[model samples]
Target: MVGASIANFTEIRGYIKGRAVLGKSATEIFKDVVDIYGKGWMSYRTVCRWAKKFASGRVSIENDTKTGRKVSISTKLAEARIQELLLEDARYTVRELAKLTGVSSSTVHFILKKQLKVRKITARWIPHLLTVEQKRSRVQCARKILKMAQKIEKNNFPDLVMGDETWIYFENYEPHRKISNKVWATKAAKRPCIAKRTMSVRKMLYAIFFTARGLAIQVPVPKGRGITGKFYRDVVLKKLDKYFGKIQPKSGMRHIKLLHDNAPVHKAAIVTDFLSGKHVTVLQHPPYSPDLSRCDFFLFPRLKKILAGRKYSKRPSVGSAIYQCLISIPTKDYIRAFQMWLKRLKI
Candidate 1:
């Protein structure tokens, strides 16, 4: 977080500020500083920048060192610094200005934004333009549910794992391509035939249910879309046998929190029975909130990134690639994504 200065900057800084306060443009300042400092001390860009900050009031008059060289400042300089910063990159942080202009963070922040009438950086939460009743109801519902979820989320159990499944595509391996309007040899890009492999061979479906710790088994879903009671029981539940089988059945044995969406397959009586029998409590995510699903928003994207350029022709095949990719993604990203999910609880 902390490191020493990349350059010996005081003298050069004062030189730039002096010129900047003299009502000079960055280019003009750059030329003057180079002429005086002779390129041995500071780069044109760096010096020009310090001048701009000083003129804009980002570098305060207080910074004028009385010893070797002194940079003069005026009221116009402070105002100029403010205008320059806003007209340039308004998003430039005070910390960034401090580093660039060799001024204190507080000085830059106060001068550029607070003192000089620059815009404040806030969330800018605009109203939804909703009907009065609808907006009121939405706010009320958000507050009510947030209150309940907050209690459970903060206190009910620290060991919670929300689960969701996502599809990983093999086309991510395909090189970027472009089509020409002029002509082409043939349409090798024709859609896949329905007559082949009953619509499953184009890409195999894998179900991933993961959390902060790790994921359960990921396997090929023969029927990805139509996973019913029978299919869910035999294929999906059977693969996750470790979750219930000899993996510790009692509470607090592990950080065992099962989160799933409102999908019928997930809510099926049989599926509920399997989860409950294992003592894995289900956290119900709000409808249409796949963004809240950790697997969907976080793990699956990482899996895709890892397998971005890889193809099924490799030794272990697509299935193997996905399994490793699942675990290979840094845990830090996963935890960060979890925190993001937690943030959505209020919204």
Candidate 2:
């Protein structure tokens, strides 16, 4: 139990060497030897092991994990098992994984909480109406790009016009609410047509382009009509002819691509023949795929913005106002809206 000589770092190391050869335990070594180097910061057990190794003349320091030897889960194994379970069934509930892994539910919960990092939920599909198959078809019809080489051979792509008609009835306003819920309930009981004042109006059919980095009106229905397959071919083809007929093939325009939904008007017999005769390639969107349609996604909102909160005297008056507003919305805005589709097409 003699005090060691005070010295520089080298002298301290030498003192540690002499004391360690004298064979002291970790408590003794840490109290005396650790101050030699690294500014007295070498840990207690660390000091003990280095001195003992030096005394025994062991060639290597044995670095190891021995933190009190408490039982612990193998993190690597836990991660691998978690991944395996996730792949086998992505929807596997956390509780279910706990049972399968024989791990405590709390531990499984912690793992998922820390690492799952899943996104917030979103809508899977529109309610009712179109089946899964129908939604897929509609997007394809609207967005499909064909090589205009065949069009170059004959020229119809620039003439390609995609048109869709959508409804915006005044009666179609989102169900109303009031600040005073109790007072409004009785008033809300009556049907919107009779009780809640509304004047429903129809929007004219709209047709536009989805080609060569642009979109514009081929023909817009200045006045809307009840949708049917027959009306589409007849009305759509005629309007296309009226507008695009003016463009010559040598003007660098080729092939006409027309897009519309699988509504009754689109598949009319007269419409098919009209398209074939004029060399217009009519593309039918999948039913229930309105989410992808330009009319549904782009134009209707613009029209709604035009009509939003607008009070009309009657249905006919509303229709007239809509027509005037339609003409006012610049073609470039519609073009700008369709160009947004390009962003979705990217990876």
Candidate 3:
């Protein structure tokens, strides 16, 4: 079969040489070849090159063996040196490693990939660079929360309300720009462009409160006002209390467990005192731990995703959009979020 294939290739080359001798154009010969053998047998450029060679009175149809030094630098010593350079600085680029090891970039790449078996990756982002003590505290807090969750009756889990505040910009790009902003276009077509803009300074701070049932209330902090302890106690907690009363008038604020982050405002005397007076059990949350917060991990992300890439002229419009997105979330998703929160505690 191999000998037959070789003879067939030689026949094709001889046909090209004959066509060239007959003064046929390269394009005409290429078309004739394509008509006989089909497209994948040979490219037009290859046919043109062979026709030119034959027209120049060349006899040999085989490829010329002209070459420079062959690359054989993927040695054990080179692999060891590459490994040492990577150990010294893992951020070294392939070209940089090649220069240092006196090997071609392709050779260095082979050693790093095939022999050393290493890959480069971006550094993972974390909420905080935690110290040893902070890490210990996180584990302890997780254990305590897990214990509390196990003790709570399944039916009464809906009483657990998680709350957090985030700044909502009126106009912002989506978190996943690569996907959200992409558009279909032909290779020859000019690439689409979007104006490069920073996040809008015009934003509103909103405090969102939710339960396993769904969103309870979203309170917008008044313009020019920071989320001070006074503001939280007077505005945010008051609205939350009103919401609870409206929902369960008969059993107002009873068996309600509030889960909020360790923000300074939440830990303030006024906020703590107000919760105690209302008989609301404030769950112990570890500092710098957004992973454990239901709103941080679930609710806010969902809200932000829906709000991203949308433009709003006024703050009221932004708030309205946010409210609509919040109410649109299904109760089942809320239940799942709480379940995930408990699962994270176990982890």
Ranking by lDDT: 3, 1, 2
Residue pairs clashing in model 1 are 55-81, 56-80, 56-81, 56-82
- CA error at residue 123 for candidate 2, angstroms: 6.4
Q: Candidate 3's C-alpha lDDT? A: 0.85
Q: How would you encode candidate 1's per-residue C-alpha lDDT over 1-347 as one tens digit per residue?
A: 12223333565576677767778788887777677656766666666657767877876533545564333473346446656765787777767766656667766665665457566577565434457775565456446545555554554334555555566554455322223123444677655332222334356566776555565567566634655777776777665655544444554313366676788888889888776776665665555445557676677766776776665643237777787777776766656666676676556
TM-score for each prediction? 0.47, 0.52, 0.70
Give candidate 2 regions above 4 Å deviation. Answer: 1-71, 74-79, 115-123, 126-146, 149-158, 175-225, 233-236, 239-255, 283-292, 341-347
> Every model's Cα RMSD, please?
15.6, 12.0, 9.0
Residue pairs that clash (backbone atoms under 3 angstroms), model 3: none
Q: Which candidate's TM-score is highest? A: 3
Ranking by TM-score: 3, 2, 1
| Model 3 lDDT-worst window of ten | 67-76
